[model samples]
Every structure is written in structure tokens, then in C-alpha cells.
Target: MFEKILPFTRKKHVAGLKCAFTGHRPQNLPFRFDETDERCLRLKAELRKLIVQMIEQKNVTHFISGMALGIDTYAAEIVLDLKSQFPFITLECAIPCETQAAKWSERYRNRYFGIVEQCDKETILQRHYSSDCMQKRNRYMVEHADLILAVWDGKPSGTGMTVTYARSLRKSVWTLDPNTFSVTVE
Candidate 1:
């Protein structure tokens, strides 16, 4: 007996503006592990607002998230949430490694997987984690994006490094201050 095979259909690519996200993990955020905190709620609101602006005003059709534990997770979720209203928008998760969430708590791991499941695409940089795997992921996103949205506190960290790298490439970087709820472009 012959077995019938179905053709693989790839997701359509919409060529347009793209944005990448970079931010501190939960350990660096003011409301670490407290999603219910007022600061966290407000930060999410602001992130959602900027995403809407990107979709509506800037016509950005694609968003890349590194899938880190804090801001990356939040940004990816925001993009997925906006997909209902802006159906054309797509989210791509740039995972540093296959086991990126292996050591996380069950709750966080579940959330990460949930977001990954809903993202339109995922790019795994490497099969295993290395010292520079995170930087590699960050560079990949920055190289592929037209703009970088960073939630930073003006301190030196991975997020700061990503911002610096993006700036070095002359890419537009919009930085959001987590403490002040203000945005600055570089």
C-alpha cells in the first residue's frame, strides 16, 4: 500500500519593518518575580503601548524576542496578544539554546513554552549553551531587525551591551527606562 504524504506549507513572510527586544532578566528588574506589582503592570502597559505604535504608526510587521526570562518573555507575550487586533504582525523567538529554560522553575518554564508555542517562528542559535550563546542570540536579533526596543535602567548589563551593539551598527535604539516610565531614542 502506498502512503499519502502531505506537503509542507511554510508560513508566509511579510517583508516590512522589524523590531527586536532586549532587557534585563527578572533578577535585575525592580519587581522581580512579582508580576502583580504595580511597577510590573505599568511596565507591561507601556510596552504594549509602544508595540501598538510600532504596528499602527510605524507599520512594523515583525518582532524578535530573545526569549529570556524577564523582558524578553514580556515582549513576546505582548506581541502575541496584539496579534488578534493586528493579524498581520508576527513574532519570532530567538532562543539562545535548546535548553534555555531547563533550569527555570516550573511556572516560568511553562510560560516560556506557552509563548514559544504561539510565536510564528523560532531560531535556535545553537544546540547547546555556551558562554557567548546569549550574546550570539542578541547579535542575531540586532542584525536582523530594523529597530531595537530596550528596557534598560542605564546600567551596564546584557541589555546595555545589546543596545551598544545595535547603536554601533547605526540601528535605531529606543530605550525605555523601567524606573521612570520614560522612553529615549538613540
Candidate 2:
């Protein structure tokens, strides 16, 4: 699927390394639903802390995301917030296909489009949408990233596919296991 996008060149570029994030659209609270306000606050706090650690430890100056409903959107929002402090933190929107945002609800579409507008780069995988196109997009993301941050619920889905591809590439992969409250890399 990704026969075109070349991997990052090793020429001594002054910019920081690029890190992409791929994960399932989290259906749990603070993502899809709002349970207790306190829990929501706590979860947000933890997420921010983790994101900060990734930026500091991984030297991630750029974040690439697909703008999906749950995990992708959350990661993008965190990157946007971190941009204020780390102004060089770039957000790149890697859409599976043109008009892919149309598949989402109107509100979500608007929000996602707004984020794309704020991004430093936006790449469309195909001129049209297809079931297989998302897999192609995921492959493209894994190909370009120095590291991948995956927020997973242990489901076998697109996130799993992305993780598999990243592993095959031998890229640094960090996973936030919501079940264990820990990060692990294979």
C-alpha cells in the first residue's frame, strides 16, 4: 500500500525525530463516555503526564495521527496542547483517504477538520475511501515514524495491525496499557 512515501532521511537534520501514534478508538469513559467528573479529570491528568514523558524521553518533535474518533483524536489534542510549551512540536494529519472525515458525525467531522487545519502537514493516502485504505494508511505511518505510541485495549483491530507493522520494522514502540496502568515495549 505504501510503495511511495519514503522513510525519513538520516541526513543530520536539526529538527527532532518524528513520532507517530496508532491505536484503537477507545470506547471507554473519558474518550467515548463521561462517567464521574473526578475520574475524567484524573484520566486527563495521567494522559498529559504520559505525553510529556514521551516528548521528553523520545525526543519527539512531531506527532502523526489519523484523526480517528478515540485514541487518535486524544493523541492529537494532547500534541496540540503541548505545542504551546514545545512550539516545535508539529502535528501531522495522515488521513486514510480524501473526505474520510465525512464518515464521522457532523460535530466530530468539524472538530477533526479543525485539528487538521492546525496541523503542519496533511497527507491523503488515496483520492477516495475504501476498507483497505485504512490499512494502507497505517502502514504509511509506521514506515515514517522513529517511534510509535499505541494506546491499546488488547483488541485485535487496526491498532494491532499497526503495532505488528511497527514491530516488523524494528521501530521503537511504546504501548500504554489501560488495563495495567503501565507502558511496555516488545
Candidate 3:
């Protein structure tokens, strides 16, 4: 597996442009129910538009998603939707563990697993599960991506850690503040 690891470089490459996604798990009921309220729906639409614009402007050909709840799942959905218009677009599922899906609710678990099955590629970080291993998976995503798409609510949490790691790597990052709907490029 160590031999399979590749160094991530600053220069854009030809195989595909990869963007990793991470974000806070939505705390509100709207996200819990998997039903988009009016505000969330509007925000989701706007996010989709911004992502598509970025894909076009940056010539992104592949999107890598951790497939965690909330923002990661949403980003994958958006990229999958865009695949119709950009046939070359591919989604890679970077799952934290082999059995992580078992922790989610049946509905959500099925939905997430379905996406993983449908993705162009899926990379499971560990054969077994552990709290620390999840963190390692997040770090792996940050290390591999050329860019990061983050959804932040201006709080310190796991998503913050991801943002910090991306910054340290000097990878391009784009963020959407859930509270303000303002997009920031870092």
C-alpha cells in the first residue's frame, strides 16, 4: 500500500483534477431528516451553482469525497448531477473505514452506500474501524487533494482541522459559510 501512495504536486496534472470535500455534520433537523428546508434548499442550489462554475473555470475532471454526512455527501451529489453535462467528471469515494456505513441510520446508510457503489472509484482507508483511524482518513484526503471544498459555520471542530491541514499543504481551498452563504477562497 505504501508503494501505491503518490506524492501530490502543485502543478496541475493531466490524469484528472481532484478536489476533496469536508464539512461539519449538520446539527439542525433539516439535515437530520434529509429534507431540505427552504433556506437549506436555496443554499444547496447556490452551492451547486458555485461548484459547477468552479469545475468549469478550473477544468476539474474528478471530485474526491470522504462520504461523511452533511457537506461531503452534498458535494458528491452535486458532482454526480454534473456528470451528465461533463461526461468525464468522476467521483471517488474516500471512505474512512470498511464498516463506517454501518453506523449511520438505515436510510442514510443505504443512501451513502449506494453512492459509494455508484462512484467511479472507492478507497477505504482501513480494513478495520477505530476512532483514531477516522482522523487518519481525513488527513489522507487532505494530503491527496489538489483543492478542498469546505463548508464551515465558523466553529472549531473536525472541519477546522481539515481546513488547517489543507492550508498547511498550500492547496487551493474554497469555502461556503453556512451561516452567511458567503463563499471564500483561500
Number of the top-ranking candidate, with TM-score as the measure: 1
Model 1 quality (TM-score): 0.92
Q: lDDT per residue, candidate 3, 1-186, as tens digits? A: 111222332344356567888887767323454445775776678778877876788877778888887778888888888877776777888877788778688988987977876787778888788878668878888888889888886578888888988999899988888767889898
Please report the candidate that would top lDDT against the real structure.
1
Sort order, lDDT high to low: 1, 3, 2
Against the reference, the lDDT scores of all candidates come to 0.89, 0.75, 0.77
Give the poorly placed runs of model 3, Cα more than 4 Å off.
1-14, 28-34
What order do candidates take by TM-score, descending?
A: 1, 3, 2
Candidate 1: deviation at residue 165, Å?
0.2
Q: What is the C-alpha RMSD of each candidate to the true structure, in Å?
A: 5.2, 4.6, 4.8
Per residue, candidate 2 scores C-alpha lDDT tens digits across 89-145 of 778888888778786788888889888877777888888888898888888889888
Per-candidate TM-scores read 0.92, 0.84, 0.87
Clashes of 1: 0
lDDT of 3: 0.77
List the candidate 1 regions with Cα displacement exceeding 4 Å.
Answer: 1-14
Candidate 1 lDDT by residue in tens digits, 91-176: 88898889999999999999999998888778888889899999999999999999999999999999999999999999999889
Position 111, candidate 3: lDDT: 79
